[model samples]
Target chain A: MYASRTTQFIVGLFALLGIAALAILSFRLGKISILPTPGYVIYANFDNISGLKPGDEVDIAGVRIGKVLGASLSDNQARVAMEIDKGVQIDNDAIASILSMGIIGGKYVSIQLGGGDKTLSNGDIIRQTQSAFVLENAIGQFINNIGQSGGSKDSSSSQDSQQSQQKK
Target chain B: MQVVEFIERVGAYILDSILALGNFALFLIRSLMYAVLPPYKLRLTLRQIRIIGAESLMLIVLISTFTGMVLGLQGYHTLHLFGAEDSLGTLVGLALVRELGPVLAALMIAARAGSAMAAELGSMQASEQIDALTVMAINPVQYLVSPRMIAGVVSFPILTVIFNVIGIWAGYAVGCGLLGASGGAYFNNLAANMSRHDVALTLYKALVFGVVVMSVCCYKGYHAKRMATGVSRATTEAVVLSSVLVLAWDYFMGSILL
Candidate 1:
């Protein structure tokens, strides 16, 4: 009985130590020590944000360069705050779009920087913006459109089926 | 008849949810009370760490590496269509660290350590070992539950780390080594995409999972009545319930935390 207890105790200690060691390794890999330099926090007001939320990715053209920092509702408009890196120079006519991650992914802010030489300053608003287009919403609109054009007899579904079969 | 059956089904579902919530609430109160009035069973805690932590290491490691490689392969396949193959690290990091790390670790431990603990305790109860301990003045709760709880809490973080490490390396190996991705390019893209917040979220998952695993296993084990017939049911219940709770909590936690 005494021997069994001692063995159990020793094994437990060894296991605890192993766990701690593994935890330290994972923490190091995450590299939490590297801190980002603070950049200007500016708000983008839009009528709709779709699925966009805080911590979503922000991109310049197709390259991801920053993240959405804060989100709130103010004066009937959705206010979104973004923190872009200092290195990225935003032009005066840059457009920000609420982008869906993929065909069916999360929503994020996408920035399209134009060739204008002038740079945007702190607190300057980018007036040109577009909200995210949800696939479900698009499908709803398509169905509604199809119903309205009932007499046309487009036969779009039959054509689609025929095309699919040909491909197969 | 069909309408009545549907109503009955709905009623049963509601009652089951209510019962589960009530049981959880009662468990919380009991655990809280026990926390303040502890003899602090150090020896038992150590033993539990051995069984749950040490014994389960191999399984955790195996699961982690496989998970990482699979994530990279599938992520690459999908991301390639968009010419975003470089961001495989980002997907691996975000998915593994935030969700998979903790969930897989909990599932592995539940299958290995959790079920074993429940079965061991249940068998002892059936054989009257618990009664013998009671007669000898050894508190069964401390000898049985406390160590397992402490072990689960302590080792879960460690297991989580192992899970993440194996997964990340496996992903890098496949994505960079075999797939011919430039190591520098892959790592750079990985770093650019992942954030410190993701890692912190992963660790938080581990902590919660530890609590869930030990509580479910111990609850089933301690409450078991008939050793031969009832013990198997108890053990099965503990494993299934812990597994389900881990997944269910993942959804709720993501909604709240993310």
Candidate 2:
């Protein structure tokens, strides 16, 4: 029986406040963009993405400008669709590289902006891409080179002398 | 003969479940259609929102804060073993936003507001007030059920967003303050890793859970038998059914959405 007009008004006010709180959460905490403009999508192909997955950030000069939408295989190469925010322009020659946070960290895509007269449009493919660094491959190559050089004692001694001279 | 009896029972049970599903679908569609139709009870809807949403705010905030704090603490210790303690922020943020925030918020609402809504309706049914409304040329579904359902669907997602924000803050406090983790790293990683899509998906889950909670609870209460014990049983069933559906639907939605 709490049907008084005042009670209704008060309840309405409370509900409005709850809605305001949700808006704040969306804007401040969730970082949801309220812009109605749909962002542009571009594709980048890489030979090996390492551990890069969808939802990973796409950063340009350490600033995130886009996110990986999805990944697919095209002609034995990994194809990633990236959704970049509107008003941000990408040059046709921009390089997409899969980067790690740390030595053994999560993977993300880094975009090195290019200075080209022509600008990339929606659905444009970025041809120049660098794969993520493979730790095992680098270590294996290092060990292989060491094995190849280990048989030459004279050359190894000469290199050691040069390293000691540099230290001195 | 016993085996035949068991088969008959199983068949009957399957039929009953299918009938229940069809009835629920019809009820949901009718209620939603009423929501869009005329004679909108703005005041009643607001009152329901107050009862369903505002009343449950404190419990949501309290539970979310503690959930966030515990997640942060556990994540910090676990990630520390791999020397990736800084990633705790992203871990906590993603977990709360993606799964825990919507599921736990819905479960809480189902317990607090959903159960209460059912009990209220069940009592009203037992007292024949719903029948009285029908006698007065008013559709009980439109007047009683529609407002509650609309309020529930509107309130739940907002509550979920509040839960997520509070949980993130709680995680920040415990992980950065107590564990000596860098507050900067905690927030920075959270901001960097969590995207709008994740938040949007979370809101979608909350919306679906809200509809499920209201429909199941309201349906049970609306059709409750006209007896003292029947009303009580209806209330219990409403809570149990809605809670179980919330969890099951969460899994299905996560598999598809995520």
Candidate 3:
């Protein structure tokens, strides 16, 4: 006995869906791994890692240009090593900075490739690098400034009177 | 004295069923290894793949997407209480991968495939097709049961993987877009929580479910030639048995694996 034409339709429908599912899954994983690109890596020395890890995206002027590959420390400095795409060029005066999107956001290496005449080579060292700024401390600084501003006049007068009485 | 005799008879019936199950299991495992052996029947396998694997994808995807969205929404609310929003990605991933994906795929395939299979086999049996095959010296077991068995064995886990991956992505879309989670963070969370082993377990479950549904439908249809109305009964019983057994084994496998 033959399965109805409806059954075939249903089967075909599901097959389409399965293929779609595979496509969607692969897409979400952020790389379908078409062909591996061989790129050169450069090293930047830092005092701290600030949680920058491998596979973290690296951007130049907010455009993705490379990826962080490794972070290790030598005797005097922490080394941040990265793989830059062969297609992209980095200036010799370029700098890598560790940035946070928000208070709880993960760390990423941000490259500000300068407009220098010469480009940095594979093992070139970036002279300037910034570590991740702690959000809690920034927030604390803001609140402290607000508190000081609100009570500044009263505190100044009290200090003036106390100083005059001590002079008397 | 009568009650004692009744108890003895019921015990014997249960024992016989158990024996039948054992023999079926042994035969099933052996048949399974053969199904995987090379010099493969690419044409038949392809047809079954279309019937079994491809045809079942949509319902599985739809079911999984919704399940994931619901789980994501509910799971987010629950997890947020513990200040564990970070874990929501992993949580939804694990639920889809280990729990919902394989089980739902098996159930859907059973409904779509198992019933149709029984009906086709039953109709053939009712029309004296088995007698014709016998006269031609063809083994009905190999021709009728083996392909479906192989199809079920192969299809279930493939569907499971589809469901799991799709369901989690759907969850990610809703959770990230509608729920205002960062797409990068949500996927990173899922990638972190997901493991190769989870996929492996899902595949294993699918294989078991495949065997269960196939054997069940086959068994019912094999004996369907007993009466004039027996084919109809067998078809109905095949659907019901396959559905129940799929669910039962789902629960059983869940307990062991999860």
Candidate 4:
């Protein structure tokens, strides 16, 4: 009963505003791209990926050049696929390393450009790859070394004291 | 004898609650069926949208802007201790997009439009207008309830998107402008962390909240007692019940969707 030309106009405007808002949320804020930018895929194998996940940034000399596509395990090694932007060229001897953003931040792939003549193309694997440095493992190793050396030194000193006591 | 009486009362209460639940379910089904059937009530739906969505837009905007600013201030202070104030955008954006935006917007609408719906329908029922429609061979549920339901479902997601966009910008203003955080880091972190899944979750929650809010409000009003204070009582009950249900369903959906 309240329907009128003015109401219709306002409703139309409201609908349009809502649509525009939705568009901004989806495309700009959410960063949902309808068309995937032109890119080529490359693969690297790591002994351990740690917690590197898909969508992690792939960087070259501190600059992002691609993103991790996915990670899989084959032949007891972690195989990671990265989607590199088309224009960036990767040398045959390039190295890919899994690095963290900060001390407690998320993991990402870093590429080191090599001075090789041959340029790797799509589907080529980077031969030199470094795995993620797990903090817990490093700490464990450090503690183990300390324990071993400390025990040996303490035992050796006690044995010399025992020999001196016997001589006395 | 007392024990027997207590048992009888408990059984009666259980039976009554079950019956009420069944009635509500059937009411929702009928409203949905009418909503999708032929002879669409586009005009009435538009009018209801104007009442529920457009009229409430300003309120939603005001609440959302403040909410975003508060989030930014709080996030910046907390993250500043850890030297990560730059992540303010990510924190604010994710929190609003994932949880606050849909839930708060729906609650606001429930407070504004849902109470009005209940009062209107309750008064109409008290005056026997619904019965008159039925007597005239017109379906009152189709004529009144279905259009409101359609409008609720359509308007809620739209309003939620608007709320999110405004809230994020407001947060950006506080974070970058007032707090002196780097604008690039704020937006870069936000863009990197946000994904389509988060956006989908926002819209999905809005849709479900819309269904819940409309159903509870309409159900309460449609069956409100035909008495002097019935309209006021129904309106109060509609607002309370819809708000609670919106929150409860939001938690349930969030657990599942996330």
Best of the candidates, DockQ: 4
| Ten-residue region with minimum lDDT total, candidate 3 chain B | B37-46
lDDT of 2 at A158: 39
lDDT of 1 by residue, A18-126 (tens): 5654554434444333455456666677767877866667887667677787778988877888877677788867777787645655677888876767887667766
How high is the TM-score of chain A in each model?
A: 0.66, 0.73, 0.64, 0.78
In candidate 2, what are the lDDT values of residues B48-119, reduced to their tens digit?
888888788899999999999999899989888877877878999899988999999999998998888888
lDDT of 1 at B155: 83
**Lowest lDDT 10-mer window, candidate 4 chain A?**
A159-168
iRMS of each prediction in angstroms? 5.4, 3.0, 5.2, 1.8
Fnat values, one per model, are 0.24, 0.35, 0.16, 0.53
B-chain TM-score of model 2: 0.97
Tens-place lDDT per residue, model 4, B79-102, is 887777767878999999999999
Model 1 error, position B210 (Å): 1.3
- TM-score to true structure, per model: 0.64, 0.77, 0.62, 0.88
Q: Answer with 1 or 2, whichever has the higher lDDT.
A: 2
As for TM-score, the candidate ahead, 3 or 4, is 4
TM-score of chain B of each: 0.88, 0.97, 0.86, 0.98
lDDT per residue, candidate 3, A1-168, as tens digits?
345555556556655665555454444543333466567788887766666767676787766677777888776777888988887888877767787644454577888876678888788877767656656655665576567775776555543432211111
Q: Point out where model 1 deviates above 4 Å.
A: A1-28, A34-168, B1-28
Please tell me how candidate 4 rates in CAPRI terms. Answer: acceptable
Model 2: per-residue Cα lDDT over A31-143, one tens digit each: 55678537899998887787887767788887778778889999898889999988889997788888887675678898988786788989998878877777786666557
> Model-by-model lDDT, in order?
0.74, 0.83, 0.71, 0.86
